[model samples]
Target chain A: MKTKNMISIWFFVGCLLALYGALILAAGLQTYSNRRSANIAMQNLHLQGWWGTGLLVIGLFYVIRFRPRRLR
Target chain B: MTSIFSAMLARTWAPTSLIAAASRVMSLGGIDLTIITLYFFLVLGLGLYLKKFTSTGEDFFMAGREMTAWIAGLSFISANLGSLEMMGYAAATYQYGILVGHAYWIGAIPAILFLALVMLPFYYICQTHSVPGYLQLRYGEATRSLSAISFAIMTILMSGINMYAMAVIMKVILGWNIHFSIWVSSLTVAFYVMAGGLLSAIFNEVLQFMLIWLGALVIPVAGLIETGGWAGMVRRISENFPGQDFTHMWRTLGSFTGNPMGVHWTGIVFGWGLAISFGYWTTDFLVVQRVMAAKDLRSAEMGTIIGGLFKMLVPLIVILPGLLALAVLPFKLVPETMANVPGVHTYNEALPLMLARYCGPGLLGLGVTALIAGFMSGMAGNVSAFATVWTYDIYKPLIRKQASDQHYLSMGRWCSLLGVVVSIGTAYLVMNFSSIIVYAQVVFVFFIVPMFGTVVLGMMWKRTTPAAGFWGLLAGILASFVLWLCVKLDPSALRLVAFSSHAKDMAENVYRAWWSLLANVVVTIVVTLFTKPKPEEELKGLVYGLTTLPSLGQLPIFKRPIFWAGAVAIAFVLLNVLFW
Candidate 1:
């Protein structure tokens, strides 16, 4: 019974991360280029996008796999 | 003329650097603001939603022990990966070079494994809610009370330091009133923690962990790309520092004489690795509480192991940028930001400036949010731990021992709110002492060094008496204070402790930990021999010999905790070799 509460919490956190990830991912993809800035930092929007995807995938995995298995 | 890096990197932003960073974050557009605002409100909403579940003290403090390994592990490390750790350590790397990696590598990995393999079994089997509870069982009430008081004071001070540091950083970045930033951050953390207790804090820490990695990981990627990848950065670093040992981790570690860290492998291996790391990772309540909250022994142990694994990779984000800043940030940042101190430069601005320099509009907002998340997560970790220790160890035992669980739950919420208020007061105190804060900060290392000695002896040996534990702990703390005082009086006094001539604050800290631990162990041993030990029945499941140790005989070899520990330790040794 207590497991159900934690599963819900995990699901909630997973969904939030995925949604946030998707937002940043869209912008990152939109800014896709070799160097996103000329400020000597040379930040690649592409790599930034990859992290977004990583968070998204991990979040999705948690929500999917940790979904509570109802008692038989 | 001093280097250009000194000119460009102001020693610290009085009001201007804050404006600059605020402008950088502000320029990221309204979409960024909206996202940050929504994120804040969502966290608040989660806290409110979880309030329904925290009906008992157990639910409030431990989340009813329902946390999976992943949740516990991420929360475990996230609590320690506060934004200051990012900014502070980045600045440390900027100033000290690659040697700081020892703090994460040898300093954390082994101790974490030790906790998982040896300590977690005892903690879980005995059902101790907090580190102090372990003391009560293993030693007695006197030792437990003493530790609980010291740990209580220590945790709150740390939480305040987090609040003060973040407030100062944000104030420097956004030009916000320091008091205003303190109140706002403290209230936000206090609110969420009060509403949902540890469950809310853990959930947010997991969220914050993901956000921090997402935002922070960009600095290295961007820096590497611009610097022409790994070889380019290294080549440029060599060119920048010329003959100075900027990237060597172990080559110069053979001697404490002329090294940049001013200490040899003895300091790293004994001071940091065994004493400091073991004391902190094995016994410190802040991280240990997270481990204890896991659903079961396996989850708790695995959570610590997972944290160790993640700990191994932390340097790339935290340290690499400081190394990159050496070559890429140009020489002008130094002279531009040079403070009143002659020949000194402000490197504390490394992480924030890195964020400002690289991350574009959308990504910049994410970065700002990540910084905010880092500070908030740190604040929450402290407050919840404070609340738990206060309610369980201090208030419940001393003030009202027989209170109903429901009564204790309310007190837990009340304590969370009160802890933030205390942190705010302490934060103000810190602001006043910003210049010589290093002296005050010695409290953190001192508390742990002595506590570690007593805890290590108590857990492993059955002969350690209650009187011995109490006296040893008290003596260790006082001894640490005296050592630090001598070092502070005459920086030259460090030589008496065998510290190198070129020793800096970090070196002093390393040696101080070592001497204190040895002193603590000596005191404990002598006292234990003179006093009567607890009988066998009381020591059951508390000491190694008396306890029926958990075995993984039925599990497959790969599924065993030892398998993971071996994997992490092997990787640890290989990394040392690779860097060596």
Candidate 2:
């Protein structure tokens, strides 16, 4: 029962991540036209640049990796 | 007439004895100014009307958890928005650029989403009166007690600064002494809030938010037009601060000291938005109270998101004004302009200054009233939340377990009055702090982030033991305080030890302190994961409803979408960093 519950919670988290990913992708595509220039230096980018992209992918994976385990 | 106006301004604006003398004479017949008096009556009337809702403990304290989504959303915004955010946003926008504006967009929206999609489910399942009530069910007596105490302390400290911010404005505008302004501001709100409990608070807050929105937004629009349109305003600013990038959305991240108003980067933008939004949406009682007062879990969830939508429109009211102020004043005239205004100083006073100067007499009075409304509503919110925790979490359980519901309801009001006095007194006592905006931002970073561990773990991970929750909360807080001490001690501590310190360096960048928050959450979660899970019986009440019978249904599409919409909104807002 506990295992089943854990699976359910993870499944919910996964859904949130997937939704987060989709939104990021949509935002990226939507704003791509408006974004004419990316002026960041490499060092700055290394520190925090891919934040949007990174968060999106992580969110997507969280949803994808989530699965409901069968109740013990 | 010009002499009278200047004399009046001088009386309020002048240093020392002359200012006080002028304040006394000017205030002789100004006791009941039209706009301020009308607002005072309005607050009193609302409390009287809400008296019907104050019959029961639940009714008075939580509005019977039945507020509509719109009211909940508006009241939530009003309660927490306060003078702190209003003034801070204006100052930041004046000095920096739209990067600070992203705070509302990224943080507020995502926070609402988390509350709607994530936090709501747990609240619905647990069905506790207060969020800490949920803690009691999830952890135990000690955890609940500690959380309640910590929350009360935090609310007092935070509210104390908020009171100071409001009192400073009133002190300047009315030419009242600091002590008089503090009492007048504190007592007016306290009286109404004491009458109706949370119901009165919610009632007045709806009106308060309307005034706050109008005063903050309309002043900027009028100022922009007065300074010539957006193009004119921009042209004027560029000419003075030549070649300074005033268009970048993420400029702070580009250079550590990069021209914040120009060029681009996302470090501070992302940092502030992420920290404030998450903390506010999930942890802060002032915001969480509105969610707790929802008629049902869905209402609570949806109400928070609706508030996020309102937040998205805030920059139009707040951030734009600073740019307008900058454009209107000549570069050399900036200091003189500030000096000329009797009650305006710092970033918080910019909006007030714009209104007092540009707005006509009737509208100027209205604007002043709006500022007062914003402040009183914030005070009422703190008092109400403090009282709720005190009555429900402390007094009922510890002081009088057998007390009647009516007694508890009455106790709530007394608690609110006590909270009001303590907050006002604390504000007067702590006059030597940094700027209100920085002070508010700093407090939230240190105090709130550590709680993310307990809240997130409590909701998601059943393997989180009670012991883990207790120890995690304690350790996380300890870690943050230690970090705070380290920053103060690193150079100063050595200096003190050697008796060689003359001038101290500015403390570490706020961004560095924010990293401590992240560390606290990690430590709490990692510790929780390693501890033995709670026994199933103890966990069942929190993990699932205690109905003893099961009647399950499908999840709503909007519930999920509503949550996603928040995340989507935040992402779009972050994309603004590109314009940086």
Candidate 3:
């Protein structure tokens, strides 16, 4: 595949992951507010919000900064 | 932890931890849900995106022969690393102890290396799209058709096992609706496989491999740290499960009477390592299709070697979790938790229980998603293999000998969905069998054992006739089922049987495969003596001695396939000795 198409695919992957991450983080907010709904292990771990943020960062980096150098 | 999921022909079943776990996760909104949903979206995106790049039969079925060694090698093993494997190996190790590592080490390493060094040249040179396609050239249309039909059925049945395991386990643990889980898995697999075909399937498998490794890594790391390391973990297992051989891989293999696996060295070495392993690694179309998609012959061969190296480490990920669970996880659930879950008596819940103890929420989501990915990878692998065999080997030859490449390409897509639809029936069908993984292996034995004998004779001997191949394969299949049924009729009949039998599931599997292979070889030879063989000129490019293979002699030491093979073999010996 050409570099341009490769970049576009990765770009799209990045966007999708980042979008889902945000939604996950938002759900965690509501979950945290309702103490009855939240499980202690999950609440103690704080899984949703942080992993979502991590996904956004990873995806954004691939979308904006990553590039491969051509071989000699 | 789920049920033992084993179908012993003894009909012993165990309950899983699915119901209790699922209720708890549902209360927490099932963190697995969020991660899994995103994962599904990403997979569909990839399949749809790759669809544009896949237009012809070659591209859809074989990735247009453009994959690198890295891609091919990872995809090769990934296709085999489904949830059934991850959970099954762990559960087996929990029950059988460290002897289960043989499945990865001696069982896999040699066969993979042999495929790289010996078999790739013929397959690549002949350029058959399917393993059955090779049979057509070496044997005849009857042999190929039998193979194609049996293999097509095998793939769908195997996928059905995966689907059933995922749905059943999810329902019992996470309290998800079973039909919903099945539909989600089936539709997602069908969508991608129908859209991108094999390339999409291969690409997702590689992705799943990465996720599986990342997801599973935490369990061992956390368990070891908590237990204070490998030595500590071993010490605990010995203390908890007293008088059990929990750590040694080969130390107790002097006889079938004592080892945890209950198999003597003959069964371990000849039956498992030689017969079953070689049959699976060398000839099965599900995995071989991935290798055939490589960019070139060198890459294809190199890819298998690389895969072998990775395979040597797989036991550490899958089996070690079971050992860890044995050392630390609770054998019985607390009463409060038991209220939501059914009771069982076994170590089959080792992996998931350990996962729950080790991973919190985020990591839990990732870990569970890894398992889900494994389920889909297995389903996708079977679906894609079924499509290739159906479209290329069965449909094209028998139904329409003269169709456009486009027509076949369309047929391949439709067949991918058709295969998944058939798998739904099979998924329900396999539920009647007790254990998902064991039943799957039993299915493989009927096809692979006898099929291996036919392929080996056809490829190595010029005198092997097509009639010999057909009759040999048929006889072998018949013998396997008959032997199994005899054992089924009387479970105690195993001791009266030959080839080493301690009556355990794993050992029983080894002996059956050995018997099948022996029958296949003897029947083929006996039949060949009475029949006329194929002509010498017709055997060119198919038989070993007749075909002039591209020599690897000129390649540097580091680049040669033999060098890698030697390196892997030495490592194999070291592992056996170290574990011993």
Candidate 4:
């Protein structure tokens, strides 16, 4: 009998983070253009873009490393 | 009136305290909604996909015992990292200052290490499906039935409480309707848990742990930067509170009057650190079920140790935000009583208020999603545990004893669905009488301390007879329940239970656990002296002297469970001293 390979939980985590990172990055760009925010502190830092980029990079690494593979 | 209108329009732009007084703290924008929607789809989809793997009773209830140490470890800690706990501890820190940190450190770390080192061997070696299953193996059917019924009731009600808490938080923070929040989140959890069982719950727990950190880490980071770092934050707190010792963990704990919590060091060390912490960390099936899924005994031990390591770091995300709120927020936060009055914020709002202070649209959504993940994961943990206990310990033993593996598997899945439905009903019931939450806590206190005593004595002493185990547990539980009633009927009775009139409600709980544990120990020991012992052959693998623990002599010293546990112990000590 041929056994099926299970999808890694990390891969799912990576996908979620990657997608969220992209959306947040786009929102950050929009925030930069609007020059308005509800946040009280560190508004000039544009934390959304920086944090989003970090998540995207880390997420892509996990995706590449743990993506599901065909069982031999 | 103009300011209130502006606060309503601008949402988070206004001061958190002011906005909380007038309306919801923050509104979810399109980006935030997208993030949350994506989360639901991902969890549900994963659950459906994993359904094929869960064809057997083992797979449904125990994740087929195939998880690696890392997976099991993350899932172990995450099961306990529910949003209710997150918010409650944070609120505690806000109310009692850093004294609450004792719960994370001394109150938890020693017990977790003890579980990995002392208890996991018996549990893993015996191959019991649930905690009550272990009880049945050691004590008999009577003990198992009592434990299973109480635990089953507790888990379902606790799941309901989590659902209600999530809905209330959503209503307070985002102005979502309570019914909409409860039903939608509960249904999503029910579907996933029913579809994939423990495996699905484990996967979501791991994801929720990550999300909780990602969402909450921003608060301390931003707060530190704004205050110039920890020293600066401490300075600001001292400046703000004047004579208060909010920054010290142990210094003010020497006297109940000296601390905001009205708890002395003895209660911190003996009551919380010894009794309550051990009772929960070592015995609670909700977290233990996660570790039981490990691929091997070594993995189980390693997973628990790893969980302890991670657990030490949780304060950064949960407690720091509360501490930061004391220093950073411009206004005082009233208790729950005055929370509804305009211009007054409650201690519970510390985390959300901090999120509002730092996170704009995109990040705000991530933070909200993390909280939602926490609530769902909590529900999933409880429901999954309930299903396992109900099917294996209750239904199989009591209802039908001769069912096939397939039948049990089907029952597990159906129980998952039934548990969620009951939890939803419980959530609505709590909406009418909120005191159910307090009753739930009282019930937890009654069971956990005594159960811990029964299990530990049964595992450590070969002479502990089944009758002693059952009667000892009953004595402890009855003593605790009576003590609790005494305190409730006459508030002055707290002085006797807690050994001081200044002891607060928090202290009362801790001291109650200690007294109950003492009652159990005394009764168990006396009964054991008179009762006949089980034969050595029957006691093998379950008791300390009869069982031969696996040796790690061949493994590298650094890779040994003992080595890592020691390292964690040292770190735990350092943290207590650093914050002292």
Each prediction's DockQ?
0.36, 0.01, 0.18, 0.55
Higher-DockQ candidate among 1 and 2? 1
**TM-score between candidate 4 chain A and the true chain A:** 0.83
Alpha carbon lDDT of each predicted model: 0.77, 0.59, 0.76, 0.84
Against the native chain B, each candidate's TM-score is: 0.93, 0.83, 0.93, 0.96
Give TM-scores of chain A for all candidates.
0.65, 0.47, 0.65, 0.83
Output the worst ten-in-a-row residue range by lDDT, candidate 3 chain A. Answer: A1-10
Q: Report the TM-score of the second chain of model 2 against its true counterpart.
A: 0.83
DockQ, Cα level, model 4: 0.55
CA shift of B82, model 3, Å: 0.4
Pairwise TM-score winner, candidates 1 and 3: 1
Writing each residue's lDDT as its tens digit, candidate 1 over B1-580 gives 0001111111222322232332222244564666577678878888887788777888899888888888899988888787777776777787778888888898889999999999889888988888888898888788889888887786777677567767767766555577887887788888999998998898888888877887788889888888888789989988878887768788888887656668778888898888788888888777888878898888898899999998899898888988888878765234213434443335677777777777755567778788888889888988888888888888888889998888999999999999889888877786776542444456666777788889879889999999999999988888878988887787788887745667766776777778888888999999999999988899998888889987656888877778998999999999888887
lDDT (10s digit) by residue, model 4, range B297-366: 8899899999999989989998899999999999887776565597677777888988998998889999
Model 3: runs farther than 4 Å from truth? A1-72, B1-32, B332-346, B429-441, B498-501, B552-554
TM-score, per-candidate, Cα-based? 0.91, 0.75, 0.88, 0.96
Native-to-model Cα distance after best TM-score fit, residue B491 in candidate 3, in Å: 2.2
Cα lDDT, model 1, residue B484: 80
Output DockQ, candidate 3: 0.18
- Per-candidate fnat, comma-separated: 0.31, 0.00, 0.06, 0.51
- How far residue B230's Cα lies from its native spot in candidate 1, in Å, is 1.9
How much of the true contact map at the interface does candidate 4 reproduce, as a fraction? 0.51
> In model 4 chain B, where is the ten-residue run with the lowest total lDDT?
B1-10
Query: Which 10 consecutive positions of candidate 2 chain A have the poorest summed lDDT?
Result: A40-49
lDDT by residue (B396-484, candidate 2, tens digit) is 88789998888998898888889888887668655654244344334445556556657777777677777777777677666655654
